[model samples]
Target: MTLKMSGFNIHIVFDLLAASLSLVGTYLAYTWRLRAANAMALGKLSTGYGIALVTGAAVGGYGLGSANLILSEIPMVGRSIVGALAGATLAIEIYKRFRGIVGSTGVIFVIGFTTTVAVGRIGCLLSGLEDQTHGIPTGASWGWDFGDGILRHPVQLYESTAMAVFLVGAVIALAVRSPFFLKNGFYLMVGFYAAQRFIWEFLKPYTSIAGPLNLFHFVCLSLIAYAIYMILRSKDART
Candidate 1:
């Protein structure tokens, strides 16, 4: 049941690869005229928006990530993509409200963000137990042992695969000029990511915050609610 891997820490390599691929994908999406309007609009945003996004993402990603580890009594620091998304959303919303900007400004990021996550998780998987992103032990035939002899659910791959599928679908939607995706792609991606993450949390061994739920469960729920509210609000505005 033990899955053997190279001793070298290749997480950094995959991280770089993910970043490179995301950049390339974003550039292609922009140049190919897929969601061109949104891409151009995003490019025209003031520098303040970028500052807010980076600041919020940095703080939230590390803050929530470290807090979760502390709560779980694990002596380590980490980063959470969910936290980054939440922070970025809050920061962007505040910026938009102050500047009177409306509608989803995140459409341009859907593909790149999804690509980053879909590819970055492979780093976590290869990082093995030290990454602390592995899942609880399972007897399933596909379970992988991260040098511990215990067959655990490969939760990282599960998430990666889910996001990859979503990435494909989103790309296709963009290619076809799907109206729903054009307007609500950002919300759809956020909701889908949160929903899938919520399901996968059950397979992780993180300490429970409320009975069966962990810190991530609450974060996921908040994100799902936010996405739903935004989508509904957009619909109401149109009507």
Candidate 2:
């Protein structure tokens, strides 16, 4: 029942699906950003800004992913979307500081990212144990056997469900034009996602970079910290 290429299998399908969703998300993000005052304000600066942000994020994501691949005995577990988020965030901030651009230019990406992850995880879940996103062994009826006989926590589902909830909340917040959401939506999403991912990492058997914390645990904490800092900064800026 498993599809294969070289030595890999059907997991590639989900991986491809994730990549496709990311592309879709990128397009949606670009279009949605056009409605933002900050986005429009970029004007002639858009080209350089776009290049800087993208290059930075891509470099950061690749660097971190490479670090994981080098350090871990496991294959696919090294790559993480969180690493990309962290990379992108860091790069964007550096670029902004260098160019003196301000305000949350990342707001438009919040929902788009959530949608991408939510859709992408579907592929991860379908990829099952081979994807290395599976949770620790669990006796619960809700657990999925994956390819193994032992039932395990469906961590992929847990993350996907959390993102789905956030997505719904984000949509509603936008519909109502909530001032707080409008002002600091990106920070809110990052903080919320970091919290959820931090919790879920406990279920994952990812190799610990430190004593008990995996590479992602540190990345998640960093994300949470950055989100908090950004949220507070935004609030202060408003006042």
Best by TM-score: 1
Off by over 4 Å in 2: 1-45, 75-77
Q: Compose the digit string of candidate 2's lDDT tens values, residues 106-224.
A: 77677778877787776777776666677898878898877658788888788889999998898777766677877788899999999999999888776787888887888899999
Whole-structure CA lDDT of model 2: 0.75
Runs off by more than 4 Å, candidate 1? 1-8
On lDDT, the candidate that comes out on top is 1
Which pairs clash inside model 2?
A: none
Per residue, candidate 1 scores C-alpha lDDT tens digits across 182-203 of 8898999999999999999999
Tell me the lDDT of model 1 at 180. Answer: 83
User: How far out, in Å, is residue 26 in model 1?
Assistant: 0.8
TM-score of 2: 0.83
| Root-mean-square deviation (CA) per prediction | 1.6, 3.5
